[model samples]
Target chain A: MVVGFAIVAAWELVTAAGVIGFRRPIYNALALVGNMLGLAVLFLMLNAQFLFAAQVIVYAGAVMVLFVFIIALMNPESDVTLGPARGSEWMYGIVFGLIFAALLGVLLVNQGLTGRSGPFTPEVINAVGNVQSVGTALYTTFLFPVEVTSVLLLIAAVGAVYLAMRRIR
Target chain B: MPVPAYTFLLLSGALFTMGAIGFLVRRNPLVVFMCIELMLNAVNLAFAAISRYLNSLDGVVFAFLVITVAAAEVVVGIAIIVQVYRAGRQMDVDGLDLMKE
Candidate 1:
């Protein structure tokens, strides 16, 4: 838990403060990759074995690849600078972020959002296996959402292609 | 002893807030995109924590869907960013005001 928290803290610092350097977004991407890997471990601790694998494969692997590719395409040396935030913007970001954190922290301390623990306890997960249990629930109760997810992916692909394509003369 | 779910939730909140701050403060489109992903990851962590605490598989399923959607979002968002960069030769979010007279 401590290690994971540290990794996440480092990720936020590098991404938000540009601890390595402001111009090097590659380092930020790497930090994100590390953060994702840490989250995967946290998922494992939660008995979300399937999600752990998926997070590693999808977020840490594929999504990060896209980010790195775009960052590289931006011309590493020439357009590295993405412009610094102005004084007021920094102040706003800090104020909003701190307020958000404080509010959520208070809520957690007050036990406001802790829902009743359900049926899939650690014992149940061990008995049925994490992957099988998640697959069962996903296909049975959540089938419609699965279909919507596929359609969303299709639309995103088409939109990306359309945006990237040059207009025909 | 196993860590409490609230601990994970708190970390998630921290991450989400940090991402929001980055989104508000960063001028680069790509960094902004990364910040958005960071927020999504925070949500995933929270989902997993709640799902575990609730003793249901639903949270994992939701997080799975979120990861998939985020992948799609990255594809399209980066495409748009690339297009904008091609046109303006700048990655600054303010400089993207193509509608300015």
Candidate 2:
């Protein structure tokens, strides 16, 4: 819990204070990677060891590397491109704010969002909701989706390679 | 007093919102990419918390898979960003609309 708060607070403070310019994509990306590691620790607290490993290996490690790579490659100095949406979004933001407030109000009144406590014994792996159980459930009940995940990933991979491929001059 | 899972979730929620707003409001491709990463990390926080509550390991594993996917996203996104910048001179989303007209 402390770790979670520390990470979030650090980021919120840093960004809010403009200690590092928010427009600096590198800092934002770096902060994002740090945030992912902090969340991985949070996962450990949740007793999701496998998830923690995945988070560290995949998100903090791999995905972030890719994000950095993209940042380096994108060349932020290209001709001025997308317009800042800042001025125009205020009206829509009010609607979003109201919706967020309404949702939080409902959640607070019902207590469903904050009130859940799991009967999470330390040895929950044997009790239930472990990797094996999830695998069994996925293969049995959610087999189609499991297979589809691969298909979608493959499609994405192919598309990426194709898109990134050099054009034949 | 020690913080709680709800606090993490709330913080995660706030970070995610920032990312979303940045993605929408920031004109730079890099910022948009960073925003997307922020949202993904928010989901990771939720998964971790729920996994802990459920006393299950699968959620973390799933989160790992998500991380892997994120890595892949970086490779491709960077490649495209490079290509786009090479062809043009900027990283704004609007600059790539040569296909539309």
Structural similarity to truth (TM-score) of each candidate: 0.88, 0.74
Where model 1 places Cα greater than 4 Å from the true spot, the runs are: A1-22, A76-85, A112-114, A167-169, B99-101
Candidate topping TM-score: 1
Off by over 4 Å in 2: A1-21, A78-86, A89-102, A113-121, A126-143, A166-169, B1-5, B54-76
Chain B only, TM-score of each candidate: 0.93, 0.88
TM-score between model 1 and native: 0.88
**Model 2, C-alpha of A4: deviation from truth (Å):** 6.5
Whole-structure CA lDDT of model 1? 0.78
Docking class of 2: acceptable
lDDT of 1 by residue, B1-65 (tens): 24666677777887788788878877777878888998999899999988888888888889999
Summarize candidate 2's per-residue lDDT along B1-101 as a digit string, tens digits: 26655655665566566655555555677666777777777777767665655544455556655665665676577666666666765566655675665
